[model samples]
Target chain A: MGATEMREPSFLILTALAGGPLHGYAVIAEVAQMSQGRVRLRAGTLYAALERLAAEGLVASSGEQVVDGRLRRYFRLTDEGEQALTLEARRLRENADRAVARLRTARSRVAPA
Target chain B: MTAGPEAAYRRLLRAYPASWRRRHADAVLGTLLDQADAEGRSAVSVADVRDILGHGLLARLHLLLDVVPGRVRAVAGTAALGSGAGLCLALLLLGEWLPPWAPPSTREAGFGPFLTVGPLLYAAWLLAVAASLLRHPRLARSLLGAATLAAVVLPHVVANAYPYAGVERPSSTALAPLAVLGLLVLAAPPSRPSPAVVAATAIGTVAAVGGPMLPLWLSGGSPFPVRDFFYYAYAHHLAVSAAVLLAAGLLAAVAALVARRPAYAGGALLALLPWAVLLLAVWRRISTQGMSALEPLVVVAGVGAALAVLGGLRALGVRVRL
Candidate 1:
């Protein structure tokens, strides 16, 4: 609730909207592409996550348009969303650095030293 | 135009809460259609439907958690206390009703160990409940955790030497320890139970204890004057039924009081589960004994119909503010 940590889908959703405002389908497509098709955002999950993000002030509705007889609402990441994403990225980076450093030390010790 | 993938996707979107659907249903349906078109598919996939339903329900639960955290915790505590007490009492009554020749010593001896461990475990449980009532959340959680662990472990130690060796233990008897554990886990949240929850739990425990004692009191130390009385009169069957019906009535009242609140609605349903288990046991006994189950069956049908009607009305956009 306090942006302690973002789940993978939420992280990707925020990342998807980082570049510019995108409609629902565009955000889904962008997230799938960002995750290299490993994470497919279903309509329900995407919308639910979007709703939560909006409630948390992490996302905001930019506008809406009628595309092919359907309503397409556009959303963009808010300043809070950007800050949260940056914090999460830094946390992940720090964790990864620690793990990699440990592995390097282990390898060096085992390499005929 | 024929109802196609779009229609199917729209139907799936209905699984979301009404407020959620009102805001995002069309948007989600549009996205689903776009995804289907991108995949060159004509119908919604099973995975899509599963995702919709699973996420929708999770979102609803999250909303409930957000709205009524305290009420939810109180309901959980009440459920744990009520069910755990009911199951322990049932086991004690069952031991009492076992025949003289059927390894009675094991049960009698079992009580010695039970008296030793039971009081300690019960004291811990009481302290936990009291702490919860007094708003001492940390104390309540710690005591509940210890009491739950002791309860789960003590049963095995107390009944180690075949209390039911010569007799076929009713499978339902095995649910007691599990119920105790579940009750503790659910009720151990760091929140004070409301006055209504406390009152309901006390009433529920009293009803549970009194239900089994009613038939004994009625029989007045003499065997019940009816055929298959052991099955119906002295076997705790009537007691369990009475207990279940009483608990169900209480839960129904709570559910009605908090009809508009999703958290209480879900919690009330969860608290009614012990009653459901007891009802099933009674139904099984009634069927096995070939007794007139018409009355009980009618009660079950009536409750089911009422729930179904409520659900249907809710689905029809009726604001269930009862």
Candidate 2:
């Protein structure tokens, strides 16, 4: 229940790429949209996270493309990235389950018997 | 219309080092342009600019360390070995052939209570330096810290650690240089200094510093310290240590230039500093009323400062093939 090392933006980016490869802007927009646009991303922040993730072998550049008369470098999750995402998801689920079970126990204790 | 997003983002990317830019520019610029296009950004935002600028400069600093072998540990480790050798030599000089130079009521003192504590400190300190050279940073740091504490504090614990009669217990202050050296090693990040670099720094300092000691020893006896011009033999030896220290340090710097190892040069400066302090203490032993204390300290300090700057200049991007 403790894989909190990955920041929310990084987790979102990795999750966005899990569906397949996406270019830089697509990943940014997808992350923002996934978080209901509450997590807007700047280009610089995205690159920094991408570089860190790439260095950690969690994400990598799949290839490049020329999109709408501009360069688009696509990124995808690696096997390691998928494993990390899986672990984080599991941890999050475990934590949520524990919280829900504890709340249900407390509510039942206070309910009429 | 103002400069497009491409131009603005390209400008921000310039904060990174030339090497990083050369490798990542096109790809990174591509991403920036794509982001700007998709976001419908007419201009760069403050947060975007800040992020790029910060990371760019951070990359530059990392590249600088990568390019230069002159990491802070280079100086500290080299200083550790060099000073260790120099200290041994100075101790030998003091231990032998200089007892007559000792004043009354003190010549009979055999390091007083220091003998018990000094050996352990030396052994541990030597091991720390070895650990540093062996690339065991954690062990080296722990040992160095322990040695520093022992050097700085243990002398005071053992009463009359100095050969001087109770009239003079300079052991605590005397070991200050060793403590400083230890602290330097402990404080710095362990850089990758090849064994060759370490050996060269240690051996070169010894050979250079030892050359003068032979003649002085062979001459049969050390001359008394002179406060006046040309009358004192001790004064010449005093200058001898500092001069050779400077020469050895600069020579090491030059050798590092040849080898493209900036760390060796920095180590030389570190080695020079403690020896300078030891030399001052040696001077104080024989220094008479005629000599101004400030005079020799200034001279020694000037030499030390110059050599230190020479070593540190590598970090300033002076480009000693780093």
Candidate 3:
């Protein structure tokens, strides 16, 4: 299956990765912001998803930092996550185009009246 | 706020299963701290903490249900028993409610005939229990039933008919019988009911009896009626007797199932012997006092007869059904 078949968290995490490599907390914040404040990932859930994605060779963790005396681990999407995200974006664009075409046809008919 | 929010978060975390904590607790804690900081708050509100904790607990609860072994979860039954015993003791202590049929003569304060007869009957009960536990572990389930009989059921049997001395002491005597029952459980090896038989018998026997008795009991009715006071205490007696008999029968069935295992035979023996002795003693006590005084001797005779019949039937190559 293509990248569009990936889960919502993987999709959002890939979208967050578009900004660049981010630590666990930063990734969670960026995902929420990108989703228009709709998706807030708990650290536990995020780490769990990260662990799975890393195991699947789609994401990799790199370089930990000590911030406020707590360890913060950074994560970066691999070539696989990027390729998957590209496929998903293409699928979304195709679907959006079809819907927009249908809307334009309907709007042209309504405009005459 | 340092201690307060941490304490509040810890309190919320308690809902998570210990196993889940061992695996992912630090990560969850890190998340909570991050969220609080992102919101620019030194302390998380109780409601937010509760929401987070509730989600964690919900996940743990599902894990507990799906992943934990039934035996590990069954230990909660012991806690339930402890709570139930505590509640009963508390209620008994708090309420001065006398037995509806407490004859005026039961309170001869100083132990009279009851001291001698009670202990002996208890001993006989203990013996039978040990025997049953030895011969068939399934019968040991009746140990509690026998204790209940001796403590609750038999007293009602006697109390129903006669003007007994120190009737006021039955509730006090309750602890001894309950102790005897607990000891019997301890003396026996770990006894597990066969799942198939336990499920069938529990539904058929325990539920059959307890299902109705519970409603009656909750409504403040007597469980076992003193026979002579039967009219007034019928509902109570019926409920108590049903619970006692049903319990005894279920235990007996369980003991029988366990008896098939040779390893537990010795413990089962220790458990049964005392029970039998108590039963015989009870038979003796009740027989000696009332028209039922002949009852204990008659039971001894009947048991002998049953044995004789078994022997006779065995000699004739006939299998007699109990």
- How well does candidate 2 score on lDDT at residue B94? 34
Q: How accurate is candidate 3 locally (lDDT)?
A: 0.48
The alpha-carbon RMSD values of the candidates against the true structure, listed in the order shown, are 10.9, 13.0, 19.1
Tens digits of per-residue lDDT, candidate 3, A61-110, equal 77666666455667788898787788888887898999999999999999
Against the native chain B, each candidate's TM-score is 0.47, 0.52, 0.27
For candidate 2, what is the DockQ-based docking class? acceptable
lDDT for each residue of candidate 3 in B150-251, tens digit (9 for 90 to 100): 654455554422343443333322333244444434332124333343234224433432343344334443332222221232223222332343234335
lDDT of each: 0.61, 0.62, 0.48
In angstroms, give how far residue B66 of model 1 lies from its true place. 8.0
Over 4 Å off, model 2: A1-4, A110-113, B1-3, B67-321
Candidate order, TM-score descending: 1, 2, 3
Cα lDDT of model 2 by residue, A3-71, tens digit: 225678988999999999998778888998899989987766787789889988999988887755566
Taking all chains together, each candidate's TM-score versus the true structure is 0.51, 0.46, 0.36
Against the true two-chain complex, what DockQ does each candidate achieve?
0.36, 0.24, 0.08
lDDT of 1 by residue, B226-319 (tens): 1122235333454354445545645564565457665455455445544544444555555565755454763574366346434533543434
- Predicted structure 2, TM vs. truth: 0.46
Residue-pair clashes per candidate, as listed? 0, 0, 59
CAPRI quality level assigned to candidate 1 from its DockQ score:
acceptable
